[model samples]
Target chain A: MTSLTPMVAELVDYYDDGEAARHFQFRLLDQQQWPPPEPGQFFMLSVPGAGEIPLTFTQLPDQNQHWWALVRRMGSVTSALFRLEPGAILGARGPFGRGWPRPGSDQTPVLLIAGGCGLAPLVSQAERLLEMNLGPVALIYGARSPEARVLGRERDRWQHKLALFEVIEQSPGQTARRTPLDALPDVLAHWGHEPGATFMCGPEAMMTALSQRLIERGIPPSSIWLSLERRMHCATGTCGHCYLSHRYVCQSGPTFGWPELELLMQQPVTTQTPPLLSC
Target chain B: MIHYRLAELAELTRHLGRTRQVWQRSGAKEWCQADASNPPPLEAGRSVQSAKGFFFAEQEHIFEFDGRYFRETLPKPAPFALIGVSSCDLVAIAYQDQFFASDPHYQARRQQALLVGLECTVPCEHGFCPTVDAGPAARPGTSDLVLHPVGNGWLLTVTSEQGRKSLQGLNLTTAPEAMKQQRQAQLADCERQFPDDQHIRDGVQALNAGTVNASTWQQMGVQCLSCSGCTSLCPTCSCYGVQDQSADQTITRRRFWDSCLYDGFQREASQHNPSDDAGARVYRFWYHKFSDDFRKDFGRYGCVGCGRCEATCPGVIGIHSVMKRISQHD
Candidate 1:
């Protein structure tokens, strides 16, 4: 999806929260050249002054307005993208990476776990699953708070197809609030195990804990899939920055299953002193 | 093939230096004096760095992009002949050739280089060239010319057409008995210094075949600072990042070396970190060297056992030692 294409669309709507922001709609400038994006695919959006960044597709599988990117203003690339107006030129190439599993009766019930921005891809997957009429899907999402939660406008769209649970960590803007990871037990119990495949995306600590909990609940290792993020210099595998044990996060995966638990959970942590994040 | 006296050899090295700075491969800046016990004036030991610095320079520009224009350019390279190169380094160069030469951008820069090989009379203690079939000495196609120490003089074998031209300017001697004797002694000395390479291959094999847990890798992590020193010193590691520089209208693209050990290397715009911890990052280094892709490309292992990384590493976490430890584990 990273081929250079001019995408111009109506700036339909824009919403901004401090940490992340969402663009409701974007027009694909070159619709004729726009290639179809897989459900789990992503696009590399290029901003002139800043640089290029990878964002997951959020608008439904084959919906209108070309594509959508959920940008979190944490880095230089996204911060630059956030400042662009509706008609501004945003260069994009992608819709890359392996997407969600094809809807099939061959598999059991499906469990989707998302935390914070982790919800981006799952939302895309949920929309596609409904179009295919594949169900009994459950969407389990955890966030710091309800106000910080995103896609409230799209709530009605999800409620009809998937059983949705939004676990908010804090009590409205309270300083002393719990994290969504702290409420894992309730989320797990609410899902009620019936041997279904699971897809999880979010922070590493949260994903690790969630996978462990699901494993204890008797879910098969092969049944759970995980999307991971590593530092990436070149979204192509050549840079080796995003390289994991035996995989390249940008190449082999941003996704894996329970069978790879050891590669993630068992590997030794690097001792290189990490630089503190400067504000 | 031709022969040259010690004085003639020294002059050739001086001439090569004019093309580019000729630091002896793995040689320290200082020279070793001749002792009564060791007659020939030998340069101290081999340098702890590889020839990688020449081909894939520590810092390189691929392209530059500014507001409007970008011109693609490579670093200005003066034709150079890297002498005293080990078989291991040559093999490592072979691996790099597969990488850069495969791409037209890299091939352009590589075409400007030359190789001068030297046979070792005394191999470095840490070097394990024979195990990977990289050396006790230079391979056939490794260099344009090979210099074998012969008695009081040297046996210079020209391996390429370019080497023959380079030798045209030199005053050389016919092969003599004393030179033959010196060559035999050098070969014998290398065998005595390091007899077999099976140990290195065995250790690497063990690490690959074993299923050691994360604790082992984590334990090794205590000493690692992720300084990127190890990666920088490794000859076969070819990972790099591309940056663009542009001004006014023309744009240029450039590539710089990158290490997997850095945290920022994998940090995404979303602030999600996949291998944020040390264990996952360290695992990446070992896995790449032993990965299926590296093996398929090189026909064996990616590491040539030069030991430069082990020597320069502040952490003292030798890849050879780690492979051995993993192999010993159940």
Candidate 2:
């Protein structure tokens, strides 16, 4: 792939999920063409002067050749993206990294878990599985509160397609408040953990804890997958910014099976936060 | 192998200077892009700056965009010849050649340049090339041409077709067997003179065995100001970051050398950084150099033992100091 060249894409649609996240849909310029991005794969999105940042595909390219992403305004680039108008032109490179693995057969069940904005990639995967008529699919999503839940408008449509369990950690009303992990045992019992695949996208602590719990529940490490986030620049393997020991997150993965991530999980968490920069 | 007097070698430099710029090690620790009119002095050891930037480039515009369309900014460097590069840097260039094998920008410059390597008969201060199998003498095929100082002249061996073509018009005679033997003796003497590097060996062992504690790395991190001096001077550091700049509605995306020592190197847009701590960053940097897992990919340690990091690091956290500290921690 000619990933070094930044192709221009025009913003066609814009929407907000909450106070923290914004979603944008774009159409690639006439000269640029890319295959529909797979779930969990990402692109380096940029606006002039704000610098480039990696964003996973929230929606694959549709019949009209439009793609979408969910971006949170936690840093400079996303802040610039949040401020852009519908007609603004943005620069992008790649539909990079290996995405989530496809199911082996239509009979194989699927389980998806997500937290906060981490639900973006899982939603993409859920859409694909439902389209393929994959049997017995389920999603366990957690958020801080009902107001903070992303994609709240799509809850009814999602509930119609699969077994979706939405939980809020802190809610004011009579609705039950629980973490995704708290509801996992019943979900595992219903699906019979040995015969299905599990996918997760969330905070490191959450993923680490969930993966270990899955393993303890007799799920194979190879059958569990996670999407990871790391600082990236080249989005190709040339730049070493995203190196996790021997693997470059931009190349080897934004998605990896639990077995592949076991060693990286062992590294101690450092509290030092980097200074704000667009890169 | 062809033999030429020192003056005759200077004459060849003058000839090449007529068409292409010629660079060579001059002064105590610098390289000068000289011409026939001013032939460079024949110095020993490595130059202050590695030959990395010549091919990989410190900063390059990969592409540019106006409001309308994107244009590729591939490099088109003029033909040039580098003279008298020592073996350590030559090996590093060869290593980078493998890393950037398919990269068009690197290939653009590499294809236009000719490499002339020099065999070191004496080790320079703070160098341990032999330990990494990088020299005392230049390795075969790492350079286009290799020059061995023998007697009062030089023994020039053409290692590639490009080397033979570069010297097509300059007639020279074949050297006798005794000259080759003299070159070997000099290299052997230089290798013997390198001070013992038991500390490096012990350090690598400790790193692999997981014997070096986190507290030691934390202490070393406190000393590092993250000036990026070590990575800038390191012959094997190839990390880079990309940025875009705009003026008058036109934007250019450029890639510049980035150091892993920087705090933001592994920080995500969500502000979650894997290598956030200075100690962890320091550990990752050295781990990349000494890790056995990397050896499986690159066929050797990333370090070529040029010791440029040791000479240039302001924090004194270069390979020598870091390794020495690790080795003595227990």
Give the top-scoring candidate (DockQ).
2
| Residues A137-252 of candidate 1: C-alpha lDDT, one tens digit per residue | 77777776666676665556778777787776665556654544555567557766454778878776667777777788777777888876565555555566666655566756
| Global lDDT of model 2 | 0.81
* Residue B259 lDDT in candidate 1: 81
Looking at model 1 chain B, report the run of 10 residues with the lowest lDDT sum: B29-38
For the record, the alpha-carbon RMSD of candidate 1 to the native fold, in angstroms, is 6.9
lDDT of 2 at A86: 88
What clash pairs does model 2 have? Answer: none
Put down candidate 2 lDDT per residue, A81-194, tens digits, no spaces: 888898898777778998999887743678888888878878788888888886878888888877677876555678878778776787787465577777678766764644
Local distance difference test, per candidate? 0.63, 0.81
* Interface RMSD for all numbered candidates: 5.8, 2.5
Q: What's the lDDT for candidate 1?
A: 0.63
The parts of candidate 2 lying over 4 Å away from their true place are A1-3, A173-178, A186-195, A265-279, B1-7
Q: Name the 10 consecutive residues with the lowest summed lDDT in model 1 chain A.
A: A1-10
Task: Give the poorly placed runs of model 1, Cα more than 4 Å off.
Answer: A1-19, A24-36, A59-66, A86-95, A172-195, A269-279, B1-49, B66-84, B98-104, B111-116, B139-188, B195-227, B241-255, B261-299, B314-330
Model 1 residue B295 CA deviation (Å) reads 4.8
lDDT per residue, candidate 2, B1-330, as tens digits? 454434356866887776677887784377778767777668677788888899999999987888767788999988998888889888888888888887888889999989988888888888998888889788777898888877768888788888888887776767777877888899999999999999999999888777888888888888888899888888889999888898878888899999999988877776678887888889888988888888888888888888888888888988899999999876
